[model samples]
Target chain A: MASTKTEGARRKAGRRKKEDKASTADLLLDATSELMVERNSAEVTFADIAEHSGLNPALIRYHFGSKAGLFMALLERDAGGTFHNLETLVAADMPADQKLRHHVFGVIKTYWRYPYMNRLVAALSLESDSEAARFIAERFTRTLSEAQRRILEQGEREGLFRKIDPTLFYFSVIGSCDHLFTARHSLKFAFGVEEIDDDLRIRYSDHVASILLDSVMV
Target chain B: MASTKTEGARRKAGRRKKEDKASTADLLLDATSELMVERNSAEVTFADIAEHSGLNPALIRYHFGSKAGLFMALLERDAGGTFHNLETLVAADMPADQKLRHHVFGVIKTYWRYPYMNRLVAALSLESDSEAARFIAERFTRTLSEAQRRILEQGEREGLFRKIDPTLFYFSVIGSCDHLFTARHSLKFAFGVEEIDDDLRIRYSDHVASILLDSVMV
Candidate 1:
């Protein structure tokens, strides 16, 4: 997991010497995510990645194996940070309230930067039989769900929060945060804004955090 | 919108002679929805609809203009119920508390039965420039958003509920309801449950209601 993150991060840092830092598979993956986020995943191809990242076309297959493999790698890289951080927070013997609050920030903050991750998870998840989705579940969603469940149970026991249905609680927190990112186009239509402004980004994140804190606190 | 619902219902009711009910456009739409729900929308095609519904392939184009048209019809049909119901409740000159409570039920209950509807909305909503997505924005999303904003404003002014960012509030409501259905695979993998039972369904709806009520009630 760390390897993927470092690899992706290093590839990103190679912005100065794009050609000098050769064979960084992460650029191809970045190209894939960039295209998918701007457009749709189904329409993305290796050629598109080459065009965007200035990588040789052969490097796409040489690095990531296949199309699904490319995205699976990206999902893994990001999940390592979000889910792994959540795991750490949950495991920490900190105040349950603080842990839960910080957890909300971590989840929402990740989506704020990488809105398309939600779409990827939803897509892979719909295919239950797929190895990639199963891997994500084993590595990410279920792991985070368990951690959240533990925090909720502890918080309730400590009288810091109400007894929550953990599954719904997780979804409520996530859904609220993700809605702005996932529903950007729809929100644009509703608010008549061409794009979300920087002020709204701060407002949206704060709005989401307070909503969760107020809803869950006893 | 009401016309589409009545038309679909009347067609469904003519079920006695299933085969004799030839060229029922609703069946074609149902077949398409059924396939899309089971799998992904991109993979579903006209032949699959014909295979699933036992209808003539030619009848597909005859009834709906194209594949996207067929899904758009289904989306419109479902939106009619959810959006129209919200409009009616928002317009009703009743106590804001009662109206808002009923509104939550309308939102969650519709999603309870039609989980794929969430996926369809997300997919179409992301494609802002598409005619289908734009039509959805005008017909369903914008209209419902205005109604939700009105209810929130009225409730807060009356001191019946706390002030909330109406867009975030609406997203929170939909996200909580939509998560269990959309993330069924990851949920299944987490808890090792093969399918969501009736109990979880009831618990989920109640859980969602209480979350909203608790968060908003002053």
Candidate 2:
């Protein structure tokens, strides 16, 4: 009985250790996100992140392996579920138009919730090494584009959506979805929109989905 | 005859002096543009600009007043004509749909020619003082949005366009127009598109115009 209790204790200890590691990583990521959003930039450094997280900078290097790895991990943490949900939506039994509209809303809301995401993706893809860039493209861009392609194809098959190049559609739709969030200064200065509250986000989402649906619908 | 010759020589000297000043300023602007394009950033220092232009750094301060002034000047040089032409286009006798399609093409082409233009505008607006940001919005963002509002209103009145918010349209259209250029690395990594040639630009232009026109048309 003592031997069995010892084994159980060891397993419990192992699980507790793993949970501690995961929580520490999450704390680092949360700090990174906060710093990036507060600064409105993806150029936040390890020192900044360390100070913000109140953790040793060495912990970051240990957890993420490198800055590129940390960024990639952050992308995965923030957007992994989003991309996964997109695939599920694509596979679901909904009509093409409905799926596309939902996809549009999801993209906008994702940006709304994490204003630094698309910018982070762009920065990583632009400045990181080729391997990191490729990983990002494969994990994020390609997945989104592929899901879009499937939806476009499905819509065409359903005789609902007009034939459009999925590649071009990817750029346009993604661009339109994220613009309001990205161009916050333009909103403030040009339109006197000082804040992007939930109401504004919904309104903008409806506007984008409306126009895009109109463009693609028969 | 001697008095006439003296006056002529003095005038000639004055003209030469003015032309020399103008050319030196132009040289500085040209060097700034070249370095920005080469580095894909607007963070180029005054020292870098001076070294590239082979002009004393003091000349930049003297000619433009400050870095913000220099950026503002660059915007005027690059986009001033585009905005002026947009005003002309709005007042033209063309049909609303045709005008909007042309505007879409114009926007895409502008970003293509000056890939750094929008990014520079965003950076200036985000990082600079309120005065500079306000100036940029007044000079560029408001002008673009107002032209779009006029076009949209014209389209609605002419029974050619569905009602849409001009502000939302501004974000969507500009976002769509500039995405391909800004997401260059995404294109390279995701689509294996290493270069954005005229062919791609023309094709993308047609695609954006078609969808946007379709969305807005009654």
- By lDDT, the best candidate is 2
Each model's number of backbone clashes?
0, 0
Candidate 1 chain B: worst 10 consecutive residues by lDDT? B14-23
Question: DockQ scores for all the models shown?
Answer: 0.45, 0.70
Q: lDDT tens string, model 1, B86-156?
A: 77789898877777677766766666667677667765665434777777778767776678789888888
Best by TM-score: 2
Report lDDT (Cα) of residue A116, candidate 2: 82
Q: What is the C-alpha RMSD of each candidate to the true structure, in Å?
A: 8.0, 2.4
Chain B in candidate 1 has what TM-score?
0.79
Which one is best on DockQ? 2
Candidate 1, A108-142: lDDT as tens digits:
77776677777777666654347777776787677
Q: Per-residue alpha-carbon lDDT of model 2 for B88-178, expressed as tens digits?
A: 9999999999999899999888888887787678667766577778877899999888989999999999999988889989999998988
Alpha-carbon interface RMSD for all candidates, in angstroms: 2.2, 1.2
